[model samples]
Target: MTTVPQPLTLRAWRGRRVLALLCAVAFLDFVDASITNVALPHIMSDLGFSVQSLQWVPSAYLLTYGGFMLLGGRLADLLGRRDVLLAGTVLLGLSSLAGGLATNTGLFVAARLVQGLGAALMLPAALSTLTTSFTTSKDRHSALGVWAAVAGLASAVGILLGGVLTEGLGWRWVMFVNPIACVLVIPAVLALLPRDLPAARTARFDLLGSVVVTGGTLLLVYALIKAPDQGWGATRTWLELAGAAVLLGSFVLIERSARDPILPLNIFRVPGLAAANLTGLIGFAGMLSMFYFLTLYMQTVLGYSAIAAGAAYLPLTVGVGIGAGIGAKLLTKVGSRAVICTGALVAAAGLFLLSQVPVDGGYLGHILPGLLLVAFGVGPVFVGVTSAANAGVGPSRAGLAAAILNSSQQIGGALGLAIFSAVGAARTHHLLATGGSASIATTSGLGYALGAGAAVTVAAALVALATVNTREGESPMNKPERVLIVGRSPSVLVDAVDILRADGYTANATNQFDRVLDDYDVTDLDVLVFGGMVPADIKEQLRAKVDALNPQVTFVQGLGGIAGLIAAQVRAATSQETQDGVSYDEEKREVRLTLDTPATVTVEAWWGTSFTPPEPKSASMRVFDGQLDAGSHAVPLPEEVPAVASFVAVTVDSATQVFTVGAMPTAVTQLAPASANDNRLPEVGQVTT
Candidate 1:
């Protein structure tokens, strides 16, 4: 007989140890990106690199890292996460050593590229390991929260460390530091992480898909990186972009026929996956451009030394930690939708504030506020978006899911940099043509670019509001079928019911437990929650009555106020089987409905506080007036529904079921209502099984 592995608890020593090791790996990856920014001047002076060729030092790493991420993730699935992680760590150590010892530009650039490859491999593997090891929603959320904090903190810390190291030890030590960190990490990973399961020898690799996808991504990223310098309208830029398009199109065709594709297109069918990735892309684009432009502004306009500029980011770092901590806690109470949307809006506001900085702006008044706002706003976004992207993904494709999320950031940063660079350059040239001073022209141009970045962040917020689910505490898979809250206090009962209902539960509460026993049917309820204020004999009697009605009904005692009730609900929900096969599409404003058999399904849309389906006579909107055969069908939704609709009811014959629709991707502008006589056909789309 086989035994299932138990979910890791908060106090588990092994879980915490593994999480620490994973976070170290994540920190190293992000730190490496920013550390080189401060050391670039020293590297150029020491290696005799021309200003024109110096960009390759950073571009080489970014190109290879982004290009190979999809391939690396697929490899982790084919081989094993632990094996890939160990191999990647060794490669990173060797590359760091090579970079430190390099005396020539070519060697150093090559080492950087190799380091990026190692990072691509290790990052996905580490994320997949974390996802697989945690198993439970609570632990996974907490672990990913720490990982998000590390990612944000490392970037700021990297700049500070780079400035200190370059000024004191030299640039070589900057390259050598990673190898030393890896040496310490390797031992802990081996001891703390579980060994990978044996792989099947007969498994085939998708070499064709891998080649096309990697080559395509590399060309695309390279084009985006060079577009600002080459000019967007330049022939070389257009040609490279066209070539990338061709290669990527070929990859899609190959994936359709391949035995094992590098990236299965079906993953897009996951609820909120596509929207989450788009949100990540837009958010990162704004964030990365902000960082890039600000660094230049500090050095050129503000006349700040590298060390001073690095130190100035201290407030931003602290703000990120504070935001991430609050986000993690809020995720359990409110949900990812609320936290992510709020964060993106705040970040946009911060970017807009930064855009208002004048040519002679002061650091404390103009720069600090913007930096703090952006940092705090983006902190929660990273955590919430990451959780949403990876939720419900199986272990087999966990690495692929993580890779997709990371790739969005890379691609978004590249695109944002390219577009904003062009925008700024165009604006500056126009100002110069109109007889403005160079200083005024430059500052004005940067302000316009920052405004564009703010717009992009706003777009991200809209995506989150539309597509992300409003889940609290546990995931949908971990929610109970039904919950009954029994209590004496009306306030406590109301609060508990509200919390549970917000979490997508079929929850009901009553102050009169004995009255409920006589009037309501208790057979269908999965959980019986008793308040702490309830008498012991009364609770025992209620439990006996519930047990007599349904032996499967779980009795949870010692409930305090709202928090305790939520906690009990989570525990009960985690042990129960959950509803599946329902997904929402934000772009088309539709629900991909799946049925077990051919039936004439009536999907009634509702906008109200309660998640429960109203009586057949009470439904206001009959959104999808069609029959869906077995499989999946994209049913059109009500266009003029409120910004946040509570739920939709699917009625087949006499059976009616309610599904949450509040998390569907929302539009910035409210859509106009369709006319009654309008015969516009619903645009059909595929949903992968």
Candidate 2:
């Protein structure tokens, strides 16, 4: 009886406490950002701040939060997410406590700045934690769904919570709440979350590049926030922006020569990563500012009390929950583009509607409808872009990707708010000079600003439409992953085609490595399976060409069990069931090679009991090519390496060949020669061995 091959099995994280701890961090991020917005007036009054300085209250927090976020993300990746997360949690708690007890404006602003830093550290670490913890697609989708829902709800609900706390207990409770939550959550995080994993980056962290990038980001955010008040045409504004640009440009140069860069520029090449980050930058620029304007409209124009104004967002909060829940589930089904486009357009429509709220606007007719629409649309867009940014990313770079997305969003939000706030102020002044009422001028300014937001959101939709690929991800249950099988043996290829087709994949087979591109289009292909019989040089050449055609397609080194074993490896690559770099199968005495880049890999296996001193009882070495980019490849042991090898090590691009390995074992079947005078195909023995 023939046995079916077993694929790599992915185990989902079952630690609910770990998930909760991570979610708390996410919850804290949104709460900290949004809660302060509502309490700004109270803070200004209590801290004895002047009108111009009042803006600094929130700016202090936002400037640091947006600026340091990228550094925080890289820190999580370098130091380990668990450890970084704990550090950020502690910092945030302490900063919040300091803010709560601050006696003066300067002290409070200092506390807020540190609080922003803490938040910057926590957000990416928390997101990377959730992503790395969940190994399976379904589980990750569910977890991210829950995380997004909580964050979405927190954005609108923070305003309400701030209003309640500020009104009932005083504005100081807003600052106190963070520390209290952190104190309660710290024990759980320590008990549930795993410790920091050791890092592979041998060289020290890229300090020069990090410092330059952080300074650049901080300057850029500060300039954007200052641009409106200073006037867009101001010389100082231009100089600050230019300086920031220069610093950021220099950072790229520094990274190119750094032993290990904090941000590897190559990471942007990952499909959907750049598109998603750009989309977030544009989409969120409009979305976050809407919150600011709406709150201003309620308190400054409509004469509503803090609690009443806060209560009005209840519908928006509910809508966000519903939309995010549905969006997370629909992600792999409709793909990122469709979801992002749909959400952006819906949000645009909602923004346009909001732009029409008149001086006499009421809650239901003027505000609630628009708020609900924006909430629903914003929810899906947030979830979609987040997923797209992270799609197909390995565990090593998860934090970096998350941080990039957050940085884009933060920069966009800050820039958007500054621009809109300035435009509104300009319009309000224009109207007042033209003899309009204070209420009418204020309403007119807000309307025009919102209209501008609508236009920006439409642009975001266009970007998503142009950039995001709908066909290249792991979802769409209706269409199974497409795979192409390449090997020397006709029977093996035929068997692979039949077996994979039966296994519900769209599978194809070819015996020619040289003719792969001429015969097949690999752009939409997911996994490429190669038989051991294909020469190492030919495999490497084929991969280099295939990468140019479609770098996303994973190369899998396969072994015995025909279609069954090959199919399992394919499943593992697409689903991220196994580790990123390499895997080992003891029964088959083979190693699975996974690489993010093309490089020579020397695979060695050693066998020994306790009786050896300078040498192992048995050892085998196989040198694999100029480059092979793939999910996994078999490091099949020839007759030279016995099956009892105790350890296996893979070194990339090493000059040492060490020991020579033996030839292929005898085959069960062999291919026929090209002519009667010719010998059997060079790889026929290896094919069926």
Candidate 3:
């Protein structure tokens, strides 16, 4: 009997095997998608198709893949993920077989379209599987890092592999190869994937949403693709653009109203996730656009053969793979923000370098460094971006979040290519007007396109930098450990953290121990410092969840009450004072009071205010020096005779004392920082004796 693998202790071999299966699945997903690009020319030659008709072979697949991803994600959520995945695999296999055996161009195009639908289904299901399987943040980031690396490498690998297969065997091998690959995944998936449960909760399908978003994306892609051929201002172009706008607008409205939307609008409210998706979209768009033109420039303009052109992309593959692997390690070091921002900026630099290439520039001097830089930049960026985007999203919305991120990449790719090409066309026109040669015109246009790509990535970097957080608060430092403070005083929790930290424990500060046991993911935690509030039920539930996630989480319980616990382990560190003898640490920790004796000092509150007496027509005196004066002076200083019993009515600069008083304190009042008269005070609210 097969059951979906829940959180449990599993054999190490089983986990490794499952991970290997997923890696293979990811490789197939990427390789299968890109391989067709290599076979396009061959397919056209055999079927007697024109360039115009042949373009659809790739475009159709990309369009369908982008347009239906949201629907595919919803399907995975509604249907059992494994069931959808297996179905997609079957369809993918069948579609590949049909595409390979196509006798006519139309049949082949139809097969490609079907293949895309299968891919649409497979991509989300595969991503969701990883999310569902890897519950911990660390594991998820690792999984995505591997996924990003494979996706990056697969692009270069596809062209190389596709060319080899197409040339050595036949163009048909391009299509036939996928099904053969699919066969390997099927067995592993069947063996490793737990049985799918019939979905306990079913969502109503968003038919209107499906139509609008798909139609909008299709129209938008078409208009962009058409713009290079059709004039930018052409009536047909604007009409399609307008249609896209209306449809996309309608899609947003539909999503907002739908009881269970295919695309959840609420997910955007998550700051990290939203920023990640936006950055990914822009970065991917820039990358895809760069590739589209670079490929054309290499083959069409520079006269590189198909095999050589494919091989030339090696630098990018190496760069991205290295960058992504580095990102995984750096995630723990600098956090996601620094790594992602750095990657985006580096990628932009690469694009800028590429933009500097002249018309007749060679690959070594002109392109190699740029390509390598971009490759290095992109890999890490994707890893960090994806990790940040999916961070802390609950399990239920994992598929939806992943779908959004991937969709942004796809949509951005299409849009980037379209917009970049359009910009290139305008640049080419400007070059022609300036009496430049055709070669110069083309190169100029290409440079402008690359420039635009660089700009997009730079913008992405800025956005990520502004929005992403590097704090790893989900760890023990953010959540307090439950240490039982034995004494009656409530200072036990504070003391326990100090003691735990001193005692070599990764303890977080938690005010309420009763809630910490339930909310925090303490599966891998060691030494849970127990307080007196620890109930057997709470302990049992925590132990169960911990054992399920990871059994090594240790539990350490403290024995005494609050004050008693504080005395046993560690004494609290005193607040450090500045050179002016003023302590800045107002961390709202345990309350303590100290009296000031005839000392002139400025006391500032959180916002900076002063305190003074409420009387007027009194003699002015510098109590610290015991110097009495009849008139007021701007350089007045106050010192308490004995101790100021005045309340913390106000605060001032560090130079100003809280109050000046006789042996017995008089009335105390708070004053604003700007108050000139010591006799005036602000309104009093609460009185604490």
Best-performing candidate as measured by TM-score: 1
What is model 1's C-alpha RMSD?
14.8
Model 2: colliding residue pairs = 555-630, 555-631, 557-632, 557-633, 557-634, 593-633
Which 10 consecutive residues of model 1 have the lowest summed lDDT? 668-677
In angstroms, how far off is 559's CA in candidate 3?
29
Q: List candidate 3 stretches off by more than 4 Å.
A: 1-4, 7-11, 198-200, 430-435, 470-689
TM-scores for every candidate against the unseen true structure: 0.71, 0.71, 0.68
Every candidate's lDDT: 0.73, 0.72, 0.62
* lDDT, candidate 3, at 645: 24
lDDT of 1 by residue, 1-689 (tens): 11112234457787788888999999998888778777788899999788878888777778878888887777776687888888888888899899999999999999989988998899989987786666555677788778888888887888888878888898888889999999998998888766654211113687988999999999999999899889888999999999999999999999877655777776776678888888899888987678767777777777777788788888888898888888877877788878889988898999999999899988999999989998898889888988888865655567888889988888888899889988988999999999998888888889889999999999899888755663544543446656777766443454444344434455666767567687556898788777656678988888888899899887776222332223333443444332255566656666666777766655544443232322111113556544566886776665645546434555443344455555532320111111111112233223233
Q: How do these models rank on TM-score, best leading?
A: 1, 2, 3
Q: Mind giving the per-residue lDDT tens digits that candidate 3 earns over 359-454?
A: 677899988999998888888887887778776554345566667777788888877887898889899999899999888899889989999999
User: Is candidate 2 or 3 superior in TM-score?
Assistant: 2
Residue 397 deviation, candidate 1, in Å? 0.7
